[model samples]
Target: MAKTSWHELPRGVRDAVQRELGGVAGVEMISEGLSSDVTFVAETGLGRLFVKGARLDDDLKARQLRREISINPYVTHLSPEIRLQVEEAEWLIVGFDYVEGRRADYSPLSPDIPLVLDLLGELSETPCPEIPLRDAGRLRESHARPEDLHRFSGDALAHTDLNPGNFRITSDGRAYLVDWARYSRGAPWIDATAFAMCLMTCGHTPYDAEGIMAALPVWKTLEPGDLDAVAYYQSAMRSAWQPRLDPWTNASVAAARRWFDYRVGLEVGL
Candidate 1:
């Protein structure tokens, strides 16, 4: 889908949002969106809000909307606060508390790296709520060697998609994860594991990523061979699809493969 601008939103959407927000003074299209929706920030009489909407007929997009709605409350402080959800025959929309900032720089030289790691540390401390989240293992269950799938299940709540664009760093120097579309129940290290790969995609070496993730409780306790299979299957799944979706997928591909190789070496007693 082509990028959606604020001006392109349906009048009903604009009206419903304005009614909820008291009144809308301005609408600015935020171009940093990754999903197929019209995402924008509206300056309202009450306050500024981030709003995302898509056609109700788009099944996948609609499910993603519901997923965000279902999971955001469970992962408080990790995602933007959702103010209201507007559902109608033609559209489904939700508005969030507008957060001011840019995406975190995962590159080696960037100071934002530590801030993201710090945020993850804090997030790791948030216990899982009772909501039923998708199992993380399901993503690669078919491709995974059987034993790897068992390692992926757990009680910890994870914001499974930790890609750079999915999180932003505030001007005050804090990291906030934005997309909660893939919220899942899984082993805690999987979050750190996925993030380590994200770091590698941004030019950090696998070893450098390891240093950042080394202190997490799950990472500290996981057995080497189990970690290997999980990392290998996870990365391999990403390598299969990400290349077709984004131009920079190779960096992620390399990073995930490198981690997989390291774990494989450990398994073989090398």
Candidate 2:
């Protein structure tokens, strides 16, 4: 998607956001991420803020933006704080505190994994917020085996998308999660499973990645059959949602295929 420049927004929308920021001194366009219609850094009298705006007319973007804003109020350092929401005309703009940090790396051997894992463990323990979120099984029902969907139910709030870019590591060496757009209510293990797949993208074999996450308490109760179902379901989903063939994407897809094939191979009598 193209970056919707600050000047492209309606006068009323821009004015509204300015008021919320106590008068915007200047605005810098943010050119990352596909979810936002207009993402920019606003230098305001109050301070610098990261603003992500989306036109309310685009149904999918609107729904994602609204869901993220709704969930923002409930999140702490787990995500950026929602300080202002400017709603006017066909636009809805949200401004968040801009954290000074860098994107997390998930390479074969990076110092970030331990901190990322700790964040995953802690976030999984967080109680689900009081909001309508995607139910795990139901989210994948059309593509998943019936038995696989059952593993998704639990009280934990899952940030289902674990792209390294969504994680921010501050100068103090603390990590914070960003982008609650795909936040959902599910079992704690759901997020871990997603990260387990991510670990594979970082070059860990499926079994080895699973071992890395064995520190999570859910492992004590998780069954191999349960993992089998999840793997099949994810493999199917990946097969359906095609991405542009770049090195990273190809590598990610290959990892998914390898994991799926490995798990499926283990199901001897099924």
Candidate 3:
């Protein structure tokens, strides 16, 4: 769906929310987002907050909300507070305490790289009963090729979409991950490889031997045939990239394909 403006909310829905939470003094439309409707800042008597609204009728929107709530607590170590949910007339509105931060252009390569890796590593380390293993398998199945499907049918949870834009870096230099809709359990190394590949695709040199080696140490320990699966998944992901969507997305996908092909040959003699 195309991006929506704050004024696009149904009059009844907007009125109902105002009645319940008291009149909103201001509402500003944010960027042109792909998944959900985003508002810059919504002012209330209580405080200023970021508002994200989705059509209640859309099943995908509803599921994304539930996913956000489910994973928010588990990832508190990463960022800003997850606000309460406000359901108003056919709309699911979620308010998050806006964290002041900027999106980093490239994945922090030195200290921050390992920090992000460790944070992601910890998520895969512990088992969460709330996150069903089946969901992970389903996601991998949807994204992986038939030949490589078996490798991703594991019991580990992974943040399937780990990119710079999805992360926020606070003034104090803390990284907070946003966008939980794509979080699911699956092959652990896939997340790390996805992150690295994404970085490389965004004009960062994460494909170098040193960078690959850094991730390989962690990736190799996660599962059998992990490296092979990572390369395969990277290629698959790049193959699906649509240049018409966005330039960055297009470049990343193209770079990931080449990087994976080169890495596969160097590593497995394939």
TM-score of each: 0.92, 0.93, 0.81
Give all candidate RMSDs, comma-separated.
Answer: 2.0, 2.0, 3.3
lDDT, candidate 3, 26-97, per-residue tens: 986787446676455678654676667788788887778777777777776664566557677677877677
The global C-alpha lDDT for each of the candidates, from Candidate 1 onward, is: 0.77, 0.82, 0.66
**How big is the positional error of residue 229 in model 1, measured in Å on the Cα after superposition?**
1.2
Off-target runs (Cα >4 Å) in candidate 2 are 268-270
- Model 3 residue 235 CA deviation (Å) reads 1.5
Q: lDDT for model 1, on a 0 to 1 scale?
A: 0.77
Model number with the top TM-score: 2
- lDDT string for model 2 (81-136, tens) is 87888889899888888899999887767888888888877786677878888887
Best by lDDT: 2
**Order the candidates by lDDT, highest first — what do you get?**
2, 1, 3
**Candidate 1 lDDT tens digits, 1-270:** 576676677777777877888888988886656664788888887688888887888888888888889888866576688887888648888888888988778888789877877877877788887776788777668767877788888778788788777788898888888888778888777788888878777877767788877866667856656667767785767667634556457667777777787767766877
